[model samples]
Target: MTNMSAAAAGPNATYNFKVVLLGEGCVGKTSLLLRYIEDKFNDKHLTTLQATFLNKKININGKRINLAIWDTAGQEKFHALGPIYYRNSNGAILVYDITDEDSFGKVKNWVKELRKMLGSEIVLIIAGNKIDLEHERTVPLEEAESYANMVGAKHFYTSAKLNQGVEELFLELTQEMVERFEQNSQTDLNRTQRVLVVDDEAPVQSSCCTGSKTN
Candidate 1:
């Protein structure tokens, strides 16, 4: 177990993490990213460039993770740039507009492309946005959740406009990433203490000698 008192007394260090946002055009990918980055909502329908990059820092489990958030352009024309952003990303957030049925329909394609481009080790999350406009919602939560489950991704319904579940989703992802890091760290730590026997005796004893053993 990590010592809570030591963590509180130690100097905080920033651990770099990469995260990307993906979805079809007009799926509120930019909106959610902007809301998370700037804490301001803009309903403007501006097209994102090849990519939108943002830097953010989050504290998870008493450790700081400096996130390099890549918000990819959702236009079909910019599809060529998708691989560049997805490559080496620690996690991905796949957004779909709840009100736009077409956008919702493209979720599977986006997830497939992410798996193809980023590999299966990356953390994947499906975000259903525009939930504030319930009357305009075309994608049901159950269906979205079902698809997310099929892809083995976390599912979340968020309304960037209403500021609902946006922070919680980021926090959840941060915790997930941190938990994964901690698990890997522990695995590495466990691997470091290999038992080896060293004998200063003759060549005959060297062969039979057992190295240092762990406590």
Candidate 2:
């Protein structure tokens, strides 16, 4: 969906966008973010603090968009930390393990919490992960899709093990963020230029005073 590569944003320009990943424990949230950011997935089930950070870059519409992904712990113990990660996020991926009925059941709770803390402007994506283990699948595709539709989120089924649809799901979210940034950047550009002009003029005026005295 990103028409332009990140390289096109030039060597000096950097766009930082923030996104958060949420779901019940062992739903592959860390695996999905790791796979997307480093192209590697680990079997390790390390406990993340209230939140963990990951970074990645991609080209969209010929511009570089840098993603700051916050992977939060899904355990109930980390519930108080939810708002800490949700605030100021541009997008979110509500992940669930396809083989875990308990994880799937928590999707609505995650969404509701996010809405209460993060609000409606943030983009949301519903991700059903662990699709490679077809035999262990417990959540039906149609049901997940229906839930996503109800919440107006783009839905995806992925396998962190096989690396299926993991990148695709992230690309969709990045595309949405890039589109929003582009729309808002016109005003941002003008504001930046105005600040630049003011800074330069102040120095120029001081230099003119010294030059006039010398003459």
Candidate 3:
């Protein structure tokens, strides 16, 4: 956990986290993000460029959480740029088209890369998107859930077209992030207290050493 991504605690942001969305092209990553960020969706296929950045503020448990979200281009040619976007990200959402098995396969590769770069401390969410097309689904729900469990991620079935499960997914993610932030904050406080205790005892130890020298 030494290299864990730290949530930003700033004047304007009570708790700030960077979140990255990863998946193969046409997996509804952008759609899911748009639905979450703006509650809006387009039926037309939207291709991101290098990436798109957005800042969202939400209040969870009476504390404001600022989310820095980055939606990256999912095209094969832009795959190399993934690291640049996901580096130091506190959370990642791996979106897969439930109708496309290959999209789910690509999500696995993305998951491997994210864990390699960000490690286990980074919150991971696996989204089986396009559930509105359930009739066309090729990715089994059990399989996705099992894989998510194996990797310590939460799995969700989402449909941006129907605006279903989008809000719930973000709410779950926000709560998890808030819990992590509180835990991290407590750890830091404990570490600081330990250091202060050591510092206060330093002079006493030095005085005892001086007395020993005099004797």
Candidate 4:
């Protein structure tokens, strides 16, 4: 629920989205986040204790959007708390290491949990990370992409070390969230208009009945 916008946002940022990062430990969830938000990468692996929050602002087309990203701990001990971070998220990035088949399986479990807890309305993206070590990859691109398609999620191969597809992934999710928000708003407006039309007709029908009775 914290807002993160650039100083230049001023009044242009009309859309705000809460995005959560989920993955197995050492899958580079934190690395991917840092690459997108800070544009920095470290070779050392550091385990997240609980969860970290970051706020970043970006412009999509002509509209400004703020992304509040939550990086959660990937350790098994913290698995039970995943809902605390992702519950009400506008979008989720489910990451897995390309070199680790086990991590990919973990990603699938996370997807199931998110869907069960947050429902299908949450925008999901499957990220096959550590693509920089493609030579050591155990999970094939075709396999990952196929799973993503089956689950109706976007798929991207990213390497936080090389800063590949990190920005594009976030931007795509942000745009999707904005489009969904606008669509929902329009639907509400249309429903209100329909109700008003019905109300207007009700009064006309009453007046017509009164006139007929007088005749």
Candidate 5:
């Protein structure tokens, strides 16, 4: 659970964090992850047997952050196994297909269970995936944004096919996680200055496909 600590030691420290993706089957959780981590997406739908794992590294404001991402099986049968993968997660990405209203409801369930287990210790990021199919969108932008706000989760629209909002989604999540982690352990002298600077940065806003952010 070391990585789940979200710890970044004194000077030149690297923040290590664990992230997991959860949602109903075929919600494009895998596709969105592929787009973020590998910058590749397969048009063909491939069923995930159990789970997939990947690592991503990014530098933010002179601080190094490493993310261990766990892509879990979205099948209902695997619902009981959710705790196994998300147990020590520092952050979670709950994805729901924009075309499937049921998937969005399921994401709410995941949020409940996650809060029961991890409380507010874990960061939450919700994504309304498949923006390319906006014409067929059943999930209203207002509803998604409202729900995200209600649950204290940042929301964004992502399209794996168009590679839209993918980078922004991850970047925002990473920045938020780093800020939270830094605040939790700001007792170190070296981190004091970094914390002050982070506090003055603009508050992250929900992003749309055009990279536009909302207040």
Candidate 6:
């Protein structure tokens, strides 16, 4: 994470993170991305072909962060290409339609694939989309929450059509990514400092013997 002061030095230092949206077709993955990026939604179904990319810039605690979001194609044919788009993603949004139980099951499969390829380090959020249709929902919120906890991911209900819980979801994920990056950076810095101290002490120990020999 870039320091808030870094933004004052010149232009706001921008931190870029790649985030991918994954789920089955018609699960509102595209709608969620569209609502977040463009603040608009359509009733007609728009199936993603290969993948769609969108960039959103936000400020987190005075630091600039850019989320490069990828809305992936969820059809079976495009399944193999999912790993390609999310190869080095910093985070992921695993979406599912709350009204469709099958979609929720597919979310699990997507989570498994992500874990297998990216490991547990990638920040994950399980989005139960279509919350507007809660009256017809087949998957219970508790079930989704339990699965999210089991997989070490956060879960939230979202309704892109109504623009509810969309912004907060992305903001929370971005914050998590920033925190993770900062923690990893601090760990690396501590390790480097320890190595430098060891290297400096070696020369001091070696020079002490040389001074004794001269005496």
The models' CA-based lDDT, in order, is 0.78, 0.81, 0.85, 0.86, 0.87, 0.87
Output the better candidate (4/6) by TM-score. 6
Model 4, position 214, has a per-residue lDDT of 50
lDDT of 6 by residue, 68-122 (tens): 8999999989998987898888899999999889989999998998888878778
For model 2, the stretches where C-alpha displacement exceeds 4 angstroms are: 1-13, 183-215
Clashes of each: 4, 4, 0, 0, 0, 0
The lowest-lDDT stretch of 10 consecutive residues in candidate 4 is 1-10
What is the alpha-carbon lDDT for the whole of candidate 5? 0.87
lDDT of 1 by residue, 1-215 (tens): 11111122245855677888988988788888888888988878857888978999777666877888888889888988888777777788888888888887777887887787666657788898888888988887788899888888999999988888898888887777666655656665566543222343345544554686868
| Model 3 CA deviation exceeding 4 Å by range | 1-13, 203-215
lDDT of 5 at 140: 91
**Residue range 60-127, candidate 3, lDDT tens digits:** 75677788889999999999999889988888889999999999999999999888876776888999
lDDT at 207, model 1: 52
State the local distance difference test value for candidate 1. 0.78
Winner of 2 and 3 under TM-score: 3
State the lDDT of candidate 5 residue by residue for 4-102, as single tens digits.
454366678888888999998998988988888888999999677678889999998888888999999999899899998998888999999999999
Residues 43-154 of candidate 4: C-alpha lDDT, one tens digit per residue:
9997898899999987878887778899999999999998889877889999999999999999999899888877767889999998899999999889999999999899
Q: Candidate 1: which pairs clash? A: 196-211, 196-212, 197-210, 197-211
In candidate 1, where is summed lDDT lowest over 10 consecutive residues? 1-10
| Residue pairs whose backbone atoms clash in candidate 3 | none
TM-score of each: 0.80, 0.77, 0.86, 0.86, 0.83, 0.86
Name the runs in model 1 displaced over 4 angstroms: 1-13, 189-215
